[model samples]
Target: MTYNLNRWQGYGHDRLYVNAGSRKIGWIDLKTGRVKVTSPAGWPSPIEGMVQQWLASNGLGHLRVKLKPRKRGDEITTQEFLDRIDRSRDDDQQPAVALSIKSQRRRSNAGTDLAKNRAGSAAYAAAQERSTWWRSLGRAMGMRTEDQAWRIGAEGEQIVARTLQWARLRGWRVLHAVPVGARGSDIDHVLIGPAGVITINTKHHSGQKVRAKPEVVFVGGAAKRYGQAAQYEANRAAKLLTAAAGRPVTVLSAVVIVGAKSVRGSRSAGVEIMPKSHLLVWLLFRRRTLSRTDVDELYELARRSTTWQPS
Candidate 1:
């Protein structure tokens, strides 16, 4: 099959993205001559030969190495591929290139958060159920269920969301309750700005002690995988945004603990775990990485519902 090649000049490296119709099959690194086949369709011998022919015709035959696809993915559904391609085209057709700095700044103020408040809604429902006299008696008697946990979780998310609002005033973009895949799973909060992208996971432990080690976190003496989950969310976000922007994107993960009586220990893996009180301070102290223009571009791309939709 014939493929379209688009040259992307990145920092210290250049790549040629290969697209078959609307689907991104793979990409080739010009610096290392490495072929990274992202989709399975690009693995066949015929497709590799075609890529080689293109390299040879362009006077870069020396860069055509063996067909060893380092990465493989199952992201080639016709409907989803076409949908993403159409969204990409729409974005290109109506880019923010002509917008003046003032206008771009104004645009960033709109829709600062995208959460649907699913947890809050559920928490409200649970509260309503407990409002009855009989239910109130049960609650006062110290009876609870897993469903009641939503209330505490929702409260924590609200606290964290409020704290993140400060970042937007400084040209940072924040997205709350970022829905991931078709399942009901979601990333608690996403902060993008000069300090780069961070996926935040909120954990609520009312008056409980918490500690973070290099691998896991201990909540009231119970080991939890909060750090790993935050990291996973960050990784997924990095992958999605990288594909959408057609460039490399890095993501950081953080876990915010709300109502914790005391917090001890260090960061978990590559994830940062801290109490809610320190979230704003920690965020503000991060080193600046992206310019105003880059932040706006990435924010626009990320805010799109289609960008976070399942593939």
Candidate 2:
């Protein structure tokens, strides 16, 4: 016997909603063709088995039916089902779902560290208190260019992080703000997957025009050392990871320019320069160089503190 299925709007796309004489029964995914039984308790075992047989005969036997327990006074209307689907879709679209970065348990606060060191110095403390108002006034007047620069950089890193989180859906592993070297410098992000390893350096240049040549990158008509820096970061990561894994690790460098009005650059100075929006697509299409095992090994090594610390 053929079962009539009604198409209903689901979280990401359309789904097939099953009904038995106006009573809601279950739903099936339109894309994956997966079936779900909503009111399993309401239907008798014989009827459920028959329905399952019918679905299997209709070429849906490959997918397993998800059974949900029936609750008292629990009636699922079409509108309620649609609402639940919408909520699920929204949750799937969140960036945090894909961005799997292992966070450090004990984090270092640089500002707090500095403050602690100055606690015993009365003169420095008095000076710091007195300059607080002047500093605030300067910040209010937009004279704190250094602070603004740091804020822009931080914002760019966050955008890259969100983008990397989305990449997790495509089988990419990402670690953000990874500390390396002895001077407290950090690699903005490290990505490992089928495409091998990549060290991403985020540069936030809002409303600025960027141009890249073979050896130099110009931002807003001023030459910047972004390409050289990215290459150095990649090399450093490769050296550290190679030693930790006891195998050769090839690291590619990518510089993500955020909020640039226009970016005119390709691979120069062993670094790939692109705008923030295109980073995901670029990473997805790269030739696969590492297997799942290699990716996992590299990711674990990158996450360890000893891997980055100087010998």
Q: For candidate 1, write residues 35-154 as lDDT tens digits.
A: 555553323333445666777888877763433321234223323333443564577542111223333333333333353344344344555655667655766788874445666777
Score candidate 1 by lDDT: 0.69
lDDT of 1 at 228: 84
Model 2 has an lDDT value of 0.65
* Top-lDDT candidate index: 1
In angstroms, the error of model 1 at 149 is 0.4
Query: Per-prediction RMSD in angstroms?
Result: 13.3, 15.2
Candidate 1 weakest lDDT stretch, 10 residues: 94-103
Off by over 4 Å in 2: 1-133
Report the C-alpha lDDT of model 2 over 60-163, residue by residue, as the tens digit. Answer: 66654433323324445333444554554577542111111111111211112111121113222333444556666787887854444555566678777778
TM-score of candidate 2 against the unseen true structure: 0.58
For candidate 1, the per-residue lDDT at 152 reads 72
